[model samples]
Target: MRTADFHIEDARGDATVLKLTGDWTTMGLNQAAIRLGESLRGYSIEQVDLSELGRFDTAGALALVQASNFAMPANAFDTRPEAGRIYAMVETLERQSAEPPKRQAPLVRIFSKIGHGVHDAAAEILLSMAFLGRLMGATGFAFRHPGAIRWPAWVSQAERSGLDALPIIAVTNFFIGAVIAFLGADLLTQFGAGVFTVQLVAVAVLRELGVLITAILLAGRSSSSFAAEIGSMRMSQEVDAMQVMGVNPFQALVIPRLAAMVVMVPLLTFVGMVSGFLGGMLVVWSQLDYGPAFFIQRVSEDPDMGTHLMVGLVKAPVFAVVIAAIGCRQGMAVAGDVESLGRRVTAAVVQAIFAIIALDAVFALIFLELNL
Candidate 1:
């Protein structure tokens, strides 16, 4: 193919005629485009003669239009319908591109983002409400048909989420308890109130840290697992297969995991509390020389610690439900792609953790109002 080139024809009494010639496809035009553009510089074209134009395309048309400073004559391609259409298309595109973009003010951009975020949040809340309704309906159905309940699945999830998670939960809460004791001892000792470290550990562990730690850990673990597991099933078409066979995917996949989570979280919280107490006791003994008997006795004297324990325990099932719901819903929303699965899994973990902390704050406010 001949490379695209143009020639300046002899002037016609104040008319500057530029004749475009040779193949004008991208392969040919791309090489000569710069040279042609430079050659046309400072020349005011009154007419463009395309009588010898060959192999026209968008790239060549664009090069010609740009080189002419976007002032191609209307009748330049009157003899060639093919090149005319291409040039016309390029003209429209170039004209649009030449227009400056409208930009918003800085404050407007900030408020615009805020408005969009609020709207998105409202939409997500509505979606969550609908999902919760469907989950409840599935739960009621499983309750009515006890035999349909996948007890094996529930037990399997219980082992994976509850039993398997225990060792880590215990170790984490234990260290947290020791840290609290260390901080308490460092502070209280200055005031000659180091003995109060026992109460500090009890109140902290039984009231908040134990449940919060367990919930957060599970949110990162079981919640992400649920999303990934169900997402994989959906991706592999197993979820669709279950639906086609008249088996409720929700009943088969979600409920058992939900039930397991609800039952197991409270138990885990309890274990975490005991582990925290033991850890704090060891710290107090080593630091303040307070014996385990004294630590236990001090904790026992505060019957209010029982109320705190109840407060923590009550949050466990709610946290569990939120985690399971977020995870399963994200999984169900996954598209048929690996990217979608990864995004959904990440969203599940983040949303579950956020929901847990926010719900805990709400609980604290409610308890404070009740003076509990």
Candidate 2:
């Protein structure tokens, strides 16, 4: 039919004429199928005639076929040429709709995904172990990739992570130290041990707080930045581009970041130590008339100086690893979406900070038990 106005008289006992006049394509067929199905409902209509259907397409033919199937199984269906065309159209429409949608899965899909993840992770670990074994066999290769040093990478990283960070790290730590001195002064004054503020600032800054604070700050500044930068590169397909050009993304991106963090954290720790000491010196000299020399003397007098310095320095690389690992892992995990990249980078920063704090606490407890 040229128009949807064509219909059967007294059909379904409703005394309505089914009209059909449209494009008669997939979209049209869908509309016809829905309307026909609705009209058939709660009605005794057993068949339809479409002999006046002057034109029909594959979609119209399919819809007509489906109508016949539905009517036949439930009731006796009379077929006319025009009616047959309409029935065929509906049949095709139903078939097309019945096909599943892509990327649509069941409700428990996440569990299936998790199971696959566990399997993949296990397989990856096993493969890595096997590769390590092969490396062991290749003594020359292992020698070339020695665990002890990667001097060129280290120097490059030190320039980027440490040298570049110096000014900000120094300024921040100085303020932090000043704040601690002010607080320590007030607290110690109440105990008639005001002079001991020097010891409090010295030991706390060097032994724990200074390194931990510096690490946490860097984790925020550096780790999150690394994740975002790499994630953007990943989204733009630059990482894949590099791979296509025969460049190692890990060596080019990850190694540099990891090396930089490792080199910078120690130097930052040193900066923090100096600034914190200076901060405390300011408060002691200005408020208490203790003088810079007096505060320095108190630090020098501490017999545990070497132990405290060693503990702080040793924590640096651990902090660096946490920062770099979180950044790279999250960056590499990024999917194609901008939202996913932002979320992962934020998570990386938070995870890195938590890891740094957790590791610092563990090391502190361990060292305390060992009397370090």
TM-score for each predicted model, relative to the true structure: 0.81, 0.63
Give Cα distance to truth, residue 328, candidate 1, Å: 1.5
lDDT by residue (1-372, candidate 2, tens digit) is: 244333535655654434444545554454666566665555444444444444566665565455434443222123345544565556646757755656737756888888899997697457545533433344344346766345676687677667777777777777888888888889889999899888888888888878988888888888887888889999999999999998767666776677678777888999888988888789888877898877888889889887888898899988987787777777876889999998878988987898888898899899989989
Top candidate by TM-score: 1
- Give lDDT for model 1: 0.92
Error of 1 at 97 (Å): 9.8
TM-score of 2: 0.63
Candidate 1 lDDT over 296-355, as tens digits, reads: 999888879879988999999999999999999999988999999999999999999999
Q: Each prediction's Cα RMSD?
A: 4.0, 6.6
Candidate 2: misplaced stretches above 4 Å? 1-143, 146-156
As a whole number from 0 to 100, the lDDT of residue 347 in candidate 1 is 94
**Model 2 C-alpha lDDT versus the unseen true structure:** 0.73
